[model samples]
Target: MPQSPTAHDPNDIQEFNLDAVAGILQDEKLDYRIDEHDGEKVIRTGFINAAISFILLDGSLTMEAMWRGAPSTDAAAQVLAATNEWNLTQFAPTIRFFELNEGTLAINALRHVVVSAGMSHNQVGSYVMSSIESAVQCFEWLEQQFPDLVTWKDEHHDH
Candidate 1:
């Protein structure tokens, strides 16, 4: 026997909006402020001694965490090796090394959420928190694996 189709209420369809995302973050008790760079919405938050920037786009949201200081060019090969190793193991947020001004190496953690598929508010919050946690994990991993290349900031500061 075939099952009956469920009713499709209009409310079942969700419209992904920046304001909604912000509200969800607020509801989840995350302290964040919205900033716009060149008219693109960016949610700025801090976690685990690193600054997090969440970019609100049409169909997706991206969270990026940058390290405090850059490493010297001599450690670029090590950084690349770490990036490759982490990328092969991790699936959610990714780690990458960037060449900053003066040829210094900067490690960054990136997490992206595709919202066009209709994610719930809880799901969004989980994504944001997951990204934040990923940043912390990546930072700690680097500190443990490449202590010579990365100098960790003082964790004495409040979270």
Candidate 2:
């Protein structure tokens, strides 16, 4: 059996559904796909030029964006510094960066809501949409500082 997006009061705390979250994305007319990954439903989508994902892990929703290209080794420090600066000033879905290696960096926007009586539909949608915007903003900032990292293949989608 499958579930559908269930409506709830904004104040309701116990009932939350990813399907409903997916429905909100649909209502917004965004292209998205939801599939099971490692026993959790992973939502695959994008906002503007950034790829976005939503995952249910350890009872919280994790939203993140995949950076289009990895920066060179020389730019790792600058990337981390910028990420630290952004984390300090940003609110609601603070953007972060993962330094996978000297030559690889990834950007992420994250929000966590505990399971149980959970966030309302509006809250979920807000988190998802806001994270998308935040990730794009972070990407832009990175691009300004590290032009060499903008190796994204699609010019139309490369911001």
Q: Point to the candidate with the largest TM-score.
A: 1
Query: Which residue runs does candidate 1 get wrong by more than 4 Å?
Result: 1-13, 149-159
User: What TM-score goes with each of the models?
Assistant: 0.78, 0.77
Clash number for each model? 0, 4
**Which ranges of candidate 2 are over 4 A from the true structure?**
1-14, 99-102, 152-159
- Model 1 clash count equals 0
Q: What is the lDDT of candidate 1?
A: 0.76
| lDDT values for all models | 0.76, 0.72
- Please give, for residues 88-152, the per-residue lDDT of candidate 1 as tens digits: 99885787877777868778888877878776656666777788888888787877776765455
Predicted candidate 2 versus true structure: per-residue lDDT over 117-158, tens digit per residue: 577777777777776777777777767776776765555654
